[model samples]
Each structure stands twice: as structure tokens, then as C-alpha cells.
Target: MNFDLQGRVAVVTGGASGIGLAVSRAAADQDMAVAVLDNNAQAVEAATAELQDRGFKCLGLVVDVTESESVARAVADVEASLGSIDALVACAGISQNTPVVDMSDEEWDRLVAVNQRGVFTVAREIGRRMVARGSGAMVVIGSTDTIGGHINHAAYAATKHAVAGFVQSAAIEWGRAGVRINVVAPGAVDTPLLRTKFDDETAQRVLLYNVPMGRLSRPAEQANASLFLLSDAASYVTGTTLCVDGGLTTGFFYNDQVH
Candidate 1:
């Protein structure tokens, strides 16, 4: 299916690795000029090089999405180097699996800063540009935690909920301005972050047992959903949350025992 994204520009936060990198590669495959933004300089360099070697138009920038000034600079740089941002995929985030009683204040703050505030900062900066131009699309990467509460994931779940809320509110506010904002909540995907939680084969098997698909998701699967939302094919869609979780959040599976 043609996404009709050729020659457009896309900014993908956390584009150096995981689902963000998947999004970057997918965007580039659609012939879009991709700006790969992440906090890790080395990863950014490597990702950019790989894309360039593949003959894709891409730029890599190390950005702290939690800081507005940093985001503003990255946005400006992207526009200066590529063009006006036509789409944004806010994918930079952090996660932890700590029970409410054992979670530290610093861990809570850190997750909020990166996952919640970081998504907001990048979206706000880029969303403003989209609004000013009177046209754009955005997809914020959320999690299944946004819907179902998980064990030892109080903080992570809360931040995801915040992201969903933010997307709905922003979509409503910017709908008239020609800016569409939405969330793509992914379930268990094979990423470094997921490895932290399900490190061993036994843990992974347990996780798969809960998912109806009987397996974990691939990064490309999440990217496919995100790119669809960013494309004109979903022009009429807004203020929605698309769960690409292989039916993991169908509420039929028990999660309490997994953790």
C-alpha cells in the first residue's frame, strides 16, 4: 500500500534504536527525509550512517526531548536541514518495573521527565510548526500500560496514561488548526527496553502465553501502525489511540502473575 509519504519530512524522536529506529527506516523507505533524534550521540551517528549508506535522506541529532530549549533547537535544525516538519513521531521514552512501595522518588521523576514531559516538549515544539502551517500529523508512541494497569509498573503506567490524555486534548485543540495528534499504544515488542523486563527465555515465554498472538511484537510492526497514522490515508483520523499489541490488551489475559 502506498503511504503517499514520498519527499515529505518526518522527525522521529528516539530514532536511533528500537521502535523509533524502525519508524525512521520505514519513513525513509517511503522516500521521506527523516530526522533521527535521540539522546544518545553514538547511536544517532550509527543510525544516520546506516540510513545514508542505504541511500536514504536522513539527519541525526542528539536531543534531550525533556528540555524545551533542546527540542526547539532540534526542530529548528531539522527544518533548516530538511524542510518544514510534515509529520512527527514522538518515540523517546524510558521505562522501569518497580512496585509502588519500592519505587524511589528519583526514578519516578526520571521516568516522568523522559516519557511524559519529553513527549510533550517535542510534540509542542513540532506541533506549533504544524499548526502554523495549517497541516500536519503526529503519532505519539504509548504503551499497553495506558489501558491496563500492570504489576510493578505504577509509574510507567501513569506516564503512559498521561501521554494518552495529552494526545486527546492536543488533538481536540489542534484539529481545527489542521494538526492531527494520536497515540499508538504498543504491547510487548522485541526492543532493548523490553529485554530489561523479560530478559530470560522463561520470562519471555510467560509473556507470550498471555498474548493471544503467542509471541512478542517486532519493532517494525509498531512502526507500520505509526506510519499509517502519519500518512494521508488516516487524514480523517484524530484524537484516537490505536493499539498495535497483537490483542495483548484484550483483557482476557492475566498480567499479575507475569511480574
Candidate 2:
């Protein structure tokens, strides 16, 4: 029952918006020093300020997860400002719905650069330090698409699958060193990303297709799941992907509640 992490420090990438922001706040609520890392300088600064105004201890760092130097500098800054890192939640990702036929070389590369390479870069960098310290936890954000196929989601699914694999392998490699790695695969969340992707009617159809709850998930709901995994509550849990999708992917359920 010693899940307390009040005196620890954590890093959350893409912490300026959507689910990332919620996760960062959850870490802060547990009284951890949170570093809000993002590629947008202004967004990071603003998010940091907002969190601080809410009386949470936080720092905003502009970082490009795709760049090693950028990630290195940001991690160092977190260490210098908040002491040894206790946890890391990498939620930075980009989504594009494109069929394989419509996907261009540039688009594919860019998506992989941000969604696939970015997770590896951040996790590898932070995980190395954690391994050296012999204590830490990490959470990588994924999607329902990680488990199944979706129309126009080739690149996104591919990257999410990479994240799933990374979590499993990294957990096994680092478990003996006292480090834990896991993934939180969320369903269709009501975030700016989803808002931009679909209009009112299309959104209902796309988001609620197989969702037993008949509603999109909130970012805070996903954050809560991630917080549990990052905390000592999940000390024995690793290399697992906790689906926060509200039964959206539970195939072949009764539709008796419908109509």
C-alpha cells in the first residue's frame, strides 16, 4: 500500500494538451515535480504557467522527441530542476488517417518520425537514466488501433504496434533492474484531435461504432488509468497495455441495449 510518490519527479511529453496534459496534472496531484515537455515552446510555457497557477509544481520544456539532442537537453533540464527522475509518461504522438495507397513517402516518414521514432527516442533516453539509477517507471501512450485494424490507419497502427513491442521488450530487459514499462491504449477520446478529425454526425458514427458505452472517453479517465500503472500500485505490473477504451474493442457483445 505504499503507493505514495509525493517526493518523486516525473516527465510527461506532449504535456501541453489533450491526454498528456491530464496525465501531467495527475502526477502533480500526487505531489510529484512534473516536467511538461512539448515541441511547442509557447504551449509548454502556457501549460506550465496554468498548472503552476493551480498550485502545482511544474516546469515547461520545449522538446522535439524526434531529435536526440533536443530530448537529451530536456531530460538534463528535468534532472537539474527536479532531482532524480522517478517516472516518465511519453504521450507525444501524431495521427493521420491515410490509406496505404494514398500515403506518400514524405508523409509516411513524418508519421514514423513522430509517432514511432519519437517514443523510442524518449523512452530510450529516459530509460537509460532510470536503468542506471536502478529505479523508475514509464508509460507509453498507445491506441485501440494497436490491437486491431482500422480504416485509413496504416501508419498510426504501425507506430502504435511498435510502441506495444517496445513496452514488452523494455519491460523484460529492465524489470531486473527495477524499472517498469507499460502502455495505455486509449479508445476514441474527446480531444482536439478527435474534434478535428470528425464532425458531429461522423464523430458519433465513427466513435460509437462498437463502443458499449456509446460515448467517447475523456482525457482524465485515461490519465487515471495511466496514473495507476505509473504508481507503486502497479509494482507487479509491467509490459502490459491497459486499454482505456470503455469496452470499445470488446467484439461480439450484445446490442440489446441499443434502441
Candidate 3:
């Protein structure tokens, strides 16, 4: 399928590392001028430098996605550098594994701020511009928890559920403006974030036991899904979620034969 993203401009939050970094590289690989945004200023520079070394056009920015002013400024900077925005991949997010009963209100708020509010802030600012131009596409970084329940994932899952709802509603509102909105929900992606879920090796092993693929997804695999959603090839796909999990959300059983 043709991505048709050449010469376009895209903003990828959390693009400094992990899956966001992969998506940023993939967009640049497709000839899109990329704006890599993240709270970590140093990582942003490293990421942009890496892309530049690869001969890809890219800009790195320090952005706090939870703040509307910060997001607006970042978007303005991206447009100033690369021209009008053509796509957005809202991949800035974090994970927490505390049980619901033990989670503090502050922790809950922090999760909501980054996972839910951050997505809304970026999408709203970008969507407004896209609506005015009457053309654009966006892909939010949702998680497998968006559709299924998980133990010790109360706060994280709640925020993702909110993001999922926002995407659906925004899709309805933005469809008429030629702006497509969708989500890519990944399960057990092999990113630094995944390793933070457990304190010991045994817990990680048990978690992966149920995955039918028997391994976490690669960052590029998840990025490919987002790239498709942000491209012309997905013209008819909107207000939907593409799960890039290793079949963890669908259904999985132990092979019993693995030793």
C-alpha cells in the first residue's frame, strides 16, 4: 500500500525513544518531514540527530504534551519549520501497574494528565489546523488495555479508555473536515516502557506466557500500523483501533509443549 506521505509534515510526541522513536523514523523514511517532540530535551536532540545522520529531514523539540500552551507552541514551531501539518502521531504515554485499591489520587491524576489529557491537547490543536485546511490524519497511541481488562492496570487502563473514547468522538466530529482519526493499540511491545511493568524477571516471564506469539512486539511493528493509519492508504479507516498486539487481546492459550 502506498503511504503517500512524502514531503508531508508530521508531529510525533514521545518520539525521542521507544515506539514513538520508531514511528518518527518510519515517517522520515517515507520522506515526511518529521517533528520529534518529547519532554526529554536531550533525547529529542539525539533522536533528531540520528534521523539526520540517516539523511532524513527531521526537527526535534522539547514539548510537554499535557500543557495546552506547550503543545500549541510546539505545533507552531513544527508548522514554521515544515509548513502546514499533514499528520500527527500522538504517541506520548506512560504505564503504571499498581492495583486499583492501592493507587494514590496523585498517581491517578498524573496518569490522566499524560495519557488522556496530553492526547486531547495535541489532537485538538492539530485537528483545528487540519479542519481549517480540510485535510489531515492522526493516530493516537492506545494500548491493548483500551479494549480489555487487566490486573494492576487500573490507572493506565482508565486513561487509555478515555483516549479511545476521545478518538471515537473526535473522528465523528472531524470526518466531515477530511481529517481522519484512529488509534493503534499495542500489546506487550518490546520497548523500555514494557520493562518497567515488573520488578523481577519472573513476573515478566509469567506475563508473556499467555501471549500467543510468545514474544513482545517490536517497536517498528507497532510503528508500521500507525504509519498506515496516518497515510492515504487508510483513507477509509477512521474512528477505529488497529491492535498490533501478539494476539494477546483476542485470545491465547498456553502451548503446554514449550519447555
Candidate 4:
């Protein structure tokens, strides 16, 4: 699949590291001018510098996705610097593990703000630009936990569910205007975030038992899916959630065999 994204402009939130970083690199590799929006100012600069060193046209901005003002400013900056935004990969998110009953209001709010509101903020802002130009694509990063119920992930799961709703509604409203909205739900990916899930032994065992692939995903693998969704290759695909999980949500297994 020749995903020729050359000459395109992409804005990726949380593009400093992990899956977001990988997506930025992938887009740049395809000859797209990328603007990475991230909260971590230092990391964002470093990531941008690394990409530039590799001869990719890239820029980095510090923006808190949860804040509308920040998001708006970041989008405006990217547009001013990189021309019209051709694609948006909303990868800004946070996760926490807490029993539903014990989850604090602050924690819940933070998760929802970053995961759900962040997606809306970036997508809405970028979507407006795309609508004006009459062309654009958006690829949101959701999680398989949204499908497979997991323990102590109420906030995260709820936010991911909201992401699906956002994508669907946006697709319906914007498809006529040539803006495509989609999502990529990854299973277990070996990123800094996943590492915070548990200790080495428990995390390894859990991933092994749940994922038929017997390992966590690489950031590049997840980025590949996002790139495809944002590229012309998926021009016909919209209002959908594509699972990049390693068969984790496909079916249940009993003694390593599907029932």
C-alpha cells in the first residue's frame, strides 16, 4: 500500500514520545510536514530536533490538549507555519487504574479532560480548517480496553467510548464536507504508558495470557495503522474504529483454544 502522504500537513497531539512520536516520524517519512503538539516542552523539542536531523520537515509546539485556548493556539500556529492542515492524529491521552467506586473526582476529571476532551478539542479545531479547505482526515488513538472490559479502568474506558461517539458524529457531520474521521484502537503496546501498568513479571504474564500474539505492540506498528487511516489509502474509510490489537478483542480463549 503506497501511502503517499507527500506534501501533506499533519498535526499530531502528544507527538513527543511513545505512539505519538512514532506516528509523527511515520508521517514525516512519507514526506509530510508534521507539527507535533505536546505538553512536554522538552521532549517535544527533542523529538522535533531528532526528526529534523533525519531530514524531515517537522515542528514542535507545547500545548495542553485539555485546554481549548491552548489547542486553538497550537492549531493556529501549525497552520501559520505548515500551510493547511491535511491530517490530524489525535494521540494525546492519559490512563489510570482505580476501582470505580474508589476513583476520585479529580482523577476522573483529568482522565476525561485529557482523553475525551482533548480529542474533541484538537479534532474540532482541525476539522474546522479541513472543512474550510473541503478536505482533511483525522485518526484518533483509542484503546481495546474500550471493547474488552478491564479491571480498574472505568475512567479510561469511558473516555475511549466517548472517542468512538465523537468519531461517528464528526464523520456524519463532516463527511459531506470531505473530512474523514476514524479511530485506531490498540491493544497492549510496549510504551512508557504501558510500562506504568505493572511490574515486569506481572505485566509480561498478563500480556502473554491475554494477547494471542504473546507480546505487546511496537510503537511503529500502532503508528502504521494511524498512518494508513490518515493517508489516501483510507480515503473511502470513515466513521469507523479499526482495532490494531493483536487479536485480544477477537474472541475469548479457554486453555489457549476458543470455545
lDDT of 4 at 93: 91
lDDT of 1 by residue, 1-259 (tens): 5699999999999999999999999999999999999999999999999999999999999999989999999999999999999999999988887889999999999999999999999999998888999999999999988877878888999999999999999999999999999999998888887786576675556666677787788999999999999998999999999999888878674566534
Candidate 2, superposed: residue stretches over 4 Å from native: 1-3, 252-259
lDDT tens digits, residue span 114-136, model 3: 99999999999999999999999
How well is each residue in 1-259 modelled by candidate 4, as lDDT tens digits?
A: 3488899999999999899999998999999999999999999999999999999889899999999999999888988888999999989999886889999999999999999999998898888889988999999999986555667788998999889988999999999899999989998788887786656676666665767777778999999999899887888999999988788787873222221
Winner on TM-score between 1 and 4 is: 1
How close is each model in CA RMSD to the real structure?
A: 1.4, 3.3, 3.2, 3.0
- Candidate 4's error at 23, in angstroms? 0.4
The TM-score between candidate 4 and the true structure equals 0.94
Candidate with best lDDT? 1
Global Cα lDDT for candidate 3 = 0.88
How much is 228 displaced in model 2, in angstroms? 0.3
Worst 10 residues of 3 by lDDT: 250-259
Clashes of 1: 0
Separate clash counts for every candidate: 0, 0, 0, 0
lDDT of 4 at 241: 91
- For lDDT, candidate 2 versus 3, the one ahead is 3
Estimate the overall C-alpha local distance difference test score of candidate 1.
Answer: 0.91
Q: If candidate 1 were superposed on the true structure by all CA atoms, what would the RMSD be? A: 1.4
Q: Positional deviation of 189 in candidate 4, in angstroms?
A: 0.4
